[model samples]
Target: MANARNLSTSSEPLNPKTFLSSIFDAAVAAADAKLTIRGHLPQKPKGRTVVVGAGKGAAQMAVAFEKAWDGPIDGLVITRYGYSAPTERIEIVESAHPVPDEAGLMGSRRLLEKVAGLTDDDLVVALICGGGSALLPSPAPGISLADEIAVNQALLASGAPIAAMNTIRKHISTIKGGRLAAVAWPAKVVSLVVSDIPGDNLALVASGPTVPDTGSRADALAAIAAYGMKFPDAVMAHINSRAATAPDPADEKFARNEVYLIASASVSLEAAAADSRRQGIEAVILSDALEGEAREVGSVHAAIAREVATRNRPFTKPVLILSGGETTVTLRAKGKGGRNSEFLLAFAIGIDGLNGINALAADTDGIDGSESNAGAFCDGSTVARMRAVGVDAKAMLAGNNAWTAFKAVGDLFVTGPTGTNVNDLRAILVR
Candidate 1:
């Protein structure tokens, strides 16, 4: 699994409303949102069943588990602020994400301490996802909270892919990189993961707090050096000391751990394709692991959709195309948009008012790159709309201001945290 930063962009034909809804359905299905995990609980573990989790989806997953389970369960979870949901058994703690904060550090400590001293009979259900690496930042020995915060900021600005960012994070933290499970040793660790990374490498999601890490301290150091990052004396010292003796998995005792990838971008894309089929549209899934620059992929998708619409060569008219994966924006311009918005903007520019073609691009979590809107909607009329408002699509794209441009035309689609994250979903419908 790679970090969110490694996501690449690719495109296909999609319809605004139908495509958006289909994508949403696929994300929900991939997350197995309706299949509350508690339904699979092993009959109230012989000992206490403690629910400990961290991520943007942690609170919602905890709530779902609570709703499905029958016995009295007690636990706590930390999630990105504004991503919390009501839960009776599990007390939801709000924390910062994409960047470490004091609350996250404190909460991480509390969760770590909470799971301490678990026996073989006890169980620790870990709900992990894309944002947990930053959501649960617990600095290792001698690394001050401030220092950890500084490193986190550096990593975010570095634009390194998710796997690389997480590699560094695993070494710097006390809970990540299988340390959490190591701490809760002897107890069975049931990790329910909503994978956000390509290839679904379990060890990389959320820094593999519950899963065993195949990476090492050397790998972490390599990532830091690759980015040319400098750390404080204390942080550097810790890294130097552990450089040769990265936390040893064999030394730790979390052998009973089991991880389940409950959701993924591939699964979401398949579900979306199925939804399109239900609508009597010949839907095709382009790729679930598509990566690279967003705008460029948007142009390619537009080209394919245009071909199918005009000549009915590759895919006949009345076809729906779907794709799901995270995309990255290099951010050469001081743009106020996420990759999805940028993709939509570029797609609109490429189509140039191709009648009967519509599309939608959205991040599954309903939030795109620190912005309020999930993504955006585009159609044959999109170019005309921008022209009417005197909005130059090319200029807006160059400025990375697709969010603002879409907002002006009231085409911004906001879903307020859809309670799950499966990267991004793009759908194009040619009718």
Candidate 2:
């Protein structure tokens, strides 16, 4: 990683909007594949060096790898629609994310076939990141892509954490759970991973196509039962069977593989903090791996900010409180809000009339949930502004419709397809 420069030390006053937005941008840029992929590249092999990956950022990872490698390289990667990048040797295939599609099925089949019959001298560079699980949907034998889609839908709506969801995904998929690595056999597979999992678990990022699996079909079944996720009878039988199990971690095929976490929410949070300090404000990183229900997490954060605003107890006044992680939203209604928007909605209502408190919550990947906006911004007057537009802020949150409320109040943060994913970056500036 490169050094974080002190951007400014002047005595000028900070603009809350501009400063908070910069903190977000700094967090996202810190995890960009262009900056994070250079040093992590493996030593070129004497034989072929093929790249295969799938994620929202896989296209950009391919571009960076091409620029960094001196030897010839060619392969394929699957990225979400509208997140594709131009590359000469590597083919960038656009696919659906958070849900697999026909394009992903075809692309995933091509990706799996790219590494066939590799020798010991050949290298398989796997550029893994967030959203790879849904972007590459090569279903297991005797299962249809529709079956996998049903599983993904249930997992998403079940509000399972990345691990639980991916546990299920790995057990039923063809390319995931290190099966891709197993296929390469004698070839050394070095994975350059940009982690989006809260705890930096490489195996769960995009279901870890190139990494080993420590989970099994039994875990997936337990997750399904715990969440009360109903599936087709055929699907249930498939999970109950042993054939759905992933390759064992002790399998010799993984002996030569390497995994590197080049970028993550922790590093980005520190980068945001460094940028905050350079702008003459104290930045406190609350945590990098917080996990809970979305609105509940927002309420707790709002309480902290309120306490800071009223009484300077924790760390004194004028502090930028930062956090990063994957927060889940258990769906009770078919609402239009993602986890970040839901978090901001609850937070806005909690600190409705408080002054000098402004915050921005956004996914670093430039998409919050399935919404077009990255996230929504909130401040002391956010609820009041929503009322001005006749939006009942609390009711919106109750209905899980924070995205609509944010849009109605004109505070939706927009940064389309940032070519990276490090999960969510949230900043609360208390003045």
Cα RMSD for predicted model 2: 2.4
Q: lDDT (CA) for every model shown?
A: 0.79, 0.90
TM-score of 1: 0.88
The candidate maximizing TM-score is 2
Error of 2 at 419 (Å): 1.1
Across 1-431, the per-residue lDDT of candidate 1 in tens digits comes to 13222111214433348545755665566676447465456546888899888888888888888877777778988898999998888999988867789999889989988899989899888888778888888898778888988887677555466777777878778888888888888888888888888678877888888776667777778878876777777777777674424355565476566778778888888777766665556688888877667888899999998998899969876777888776667565676888899999999988887898878898887788778998988887897898899988889998888998898888887888778877788888877
> Candidate 2 — which residues are off by over 4 angstroms?
1-13
Please provide, for model 2 over 73-150, each residue's C-alpha lDDT reduced to its tens digit, 9 standing for 90 to 100. 989999999999999999999999888999999998898789989999999999999999999898887788999899
**CA RMSD, predictions in order:** 6.3, 2.4
lDDT (Cα) of model 1: 0.79
Number of the top candidate by lDDT? 2
Off by over 4 Å in 1: 1-19, 36-39, 221-252
